[model samples]
Target chain A: MTQNPQITPEWIAVDCSATQMRATAMGAAGPLAQATGETSKDLEAALLCLIAPWLSAQTTPVIACGWDAAPFRAVPCMPADAATLVDIPTEDARISLRIAPGLSQTNPADMMCGEETVIAGALALNPDFDGVICLPGLHSRWVHVSAKEVVSFQTFLTGELFSLLSQPDDTLDGFDPTAFEAALSETLSRPEKLGAKLFSLRAEVALMGLSPRAARSGLVGLLIGTELAAAKPYWLGQPIILIGAPGQCDHYAHALRQQGITPATLDAGDCALAGLSKLRGLL
Target chain B: MTQNPQITPEWIAVDCSATQMRATAMGAAGPLAQATGETSKDLEAALLCLIAPWLSAQTTPVIACGWDAAPFRAVPCMPADAATLVDIPTEDARISLRIAPGLSQTNPADMMCGEETVIAGALALNPDFDGVICLPGLHSRWVHVSAKEVVSFQTFLTGELFSLLSQPDDTLDGFDPTAFEAALSETLSRPEKLGAKLFSLRAEVALMGLSPRAARSGLVGLLIGTELAAAKPYWLGQPIILIGAPGQCDHYAHALRQQGITPATLDAGDCALAGLSKLRGLL
Candidate 1:
């Protein structure tokens, strides 16, 4: 939709993940229009694809998060508006773009890009919320939150490992829940066996005719379960909210359930939008 | 070396790995001629690339191993003359082709292809010897041998994991030995931390300015160390021998040395030839 003289978007919220970038034209009420595209294109071109139609004579401030835009803010700091926004110059005349930096931790070096904005959104939505927030992705992040501050965090390449070892792409369907749970328990209990466990999956197929569904599910369970074992310090005995895509969150939630703990879930895109809006309001 | 009338090859030994195929023409003394090519080529043509010149009017047997050639021979059986030679049909009139079967194990469900032949050769070279044989590869295999029999074996996809997580292919050079040792020790003690440990390598690179050599070496160490932790049952209280490419065997040997265990090393292709020649002698 071209700029409707009648309705002007106050600002646009953009989230640039490692693979893709998305933008939403936000009015005072909510999102007026949205556009999504790959990050592989020229960054300016990608941004214009969304905001060109919405551009007005008045500079449209674009609050963006992701793509490792700026230096990370070390943790043990408030999650809400944690980063100092770095103003990014634009080629377009009417676009005023700014990027929110990601977060980092020193002790066991870890970092997060878009997730920090999502975490900021979560903290802004529920200021009193304190505990753990897990964002599952190619490299799943487990974060500790207390009194609106991100205490510490850890990252796991489990998602990446699963994809490479198994299908290289996974989904919600075609996974055996039973196999998933069994694998979850296996790795959680005997994590050292993980080295051999992955190969055993192939052998099982060659020897036992393990179904594709079972193998995929088992891979998901194994990697997540191993992550849980490592992140026990962050997750166990702490309330958790998994903020990510629904399908992965379902698996994380189920895996946590097996350990007698249930985690709340939130859509990452919504949280990112909320975060951008919240950060914009502060500006 | 085109069908040399002076040095007639009695038979040819071919070893086809997942990615490449190699053949060595054997005379009464030793290898008469050798050639290597990609397995992606037609299997018969790849074999003929080396054997074509050596081919004479008289039938010259080609004893081949690898490429999961025939059905696997289950273990708790002698690695020596373990598999029945599966007669393979060949298009070339002078090519009398046969493939030695690989080995498989029940319970944990594991399998090995070309490495089985290497094990046979190791045993043939030293009859009445018994212990554990570690054949490291994309899928490293650890075999338990007693009285010339492969009692049991386990496979770890650590090499595959390292490739997927860090570099898809690795070699001996450009790795920090100190970093490697530290990572190996850490994983050997706390294997559960592997999920986080992988990311820490990236974090270390990002935050700590870890060198490429250090990161690559650390990854190699961490994966191998964790494998050692899992295969403790196989290596503990048992004499060990590592058979693989020199670069990989060096890393494995060093990792084992850290645990107060020293493993003998051998060239995998050499062992494969020995096993094929020994098996050929039986025929």
Candidate 2:
């Protein structure tokens, strides 16, 4: 053999997404081997291959291996079933070595079923987050993560509303997201007096003849301000960590700063990876 | 005598837009008089001909006057020098007539230029109305009409924002307007807490995953709640008079009852017309 390799295929951390596989091999001193990330049409099989590259050649003991709730999510899982481990057989040449799939709990009946990963990742960033964490996306989430867990959360169709308002036929189709973000910052600074300013969008137009696009931005700003005022008491002195993309992070950061609250932002994908890694460490 | 008879040419009020004419006249009012409405493609000249067959060749003051700010707005006289006038013309014809052209005392740049007209119209309905008069529209004017003049007022774009937010693609596109109105009533019942409810729109959607349409209605309720709160200080134990269209009247009535304000509604169009008529009295 090649000088008798002494690498123990022990702890494995995997983040299997819809189109990608990211895996890391760890030993006693943390990350005994390197990590590999790949774009894969078949994330599960690819993940297995990444975890145990030469499973049949060696009798390495896999002490512990954990994965995020991305793979094995096609089959619906129960709420109480999240983080549960399921055994996968080795006879399947596709994977080569035996592996345990991570369980994901989702309420199929609910409007949103598979949102636990992001929330879990967001929670991992702040274990003591007792208030709301607004995750802006195509389907925005206003999660009330508290008591060291996500107790409850709500999703507003803000992203969809923004799309509609910015669509070709909508009254405010050509709104500039940059200017709107600036306006959002302006509103956050004086949240208490925002209730009166919130209604100024239309007046700024019909009365003062502001541009339709500017009106749209103003409307978005007003709504964001209203949101800050509403969630203020719940998370007053607590840290508001915005988990999203770069631009969304800046926008949300500006909003929080306006309300005298500094926001902590983390790349959503990176956060997801880190969270999975943290969970892997526990095992 | 060549029939110098009673020629009622129609006591019509014509608002000539750039491309259309909004003419309202009563039959007893004359040739241009029919009812309040808007028309394009020469409806005004047509209406004049429609009643021409009835006039008995007498010199009845057609009263073909326009209070709009367009150049040469008068039937025979044309718009005067706008720069020289004490008050500049407002974009909306009504505002031009309310505070600037007719009253001449209001600040040309201020938002509440024509607030007195609604106040006067409300006073015409309830002479003892010494407190607040809530006028709902593009720019809702909350005025203190005492001693036959507008004392002070604040403008809220509640109606416009509600319309925008409740639009088909807005946050509340498919929401039940009736239920939204009901919620508004419930919210307005406790006006003091309106500020807190303002952010519930985004929160309910983010936390509870409310529908885009439902979220829009939630925003309306929130905005109306804020409006009620802003108007509370001016309540002064006087009867609240809501001036807007039928739908607006119902919404405000529900909101007022919720706030323990017991509002008396006046038709928006009729009040507008009545306000014009009040200006007529002043003339």
Query: Native contacts retained per candidate?
Result: 0.88, 0.05
Q: What is the Cα-based lDDT of residue B104 in candidate 2?
A: 23
- For A42-108, candidate 2 gives per-residue lDDT tens digits of 5455555566552445444332123332243322332113254444444444332223343222321
Interface RMSD (Å), every candidate: 0.9, 7.5
DockQ of 2: 0.06
Per-residue C-alpha lDDT of model 2 across residues B29-63, encoded as one tens digit per residue: 42334333343355435434333433443322222
Question: In model 2, what is the error at residue B111, expressed in angstroms?
Answer: 3.1
* Top-scoring candidate (DockQ): 1
User: What lDDT does candidate 1 reach at residue A109?
Assistant: 81
lDDT of 1: 0.85
Clashing pairs in 1: A163-A168
TM-score of chain A of each: 0.94, 0.53
- Give the per-residue lDDT digits (tens) of candidate 1, residues A92-198: 87988888888888878888888888998988777789899999988899888887788889899887787677764555476699999998999999899887888
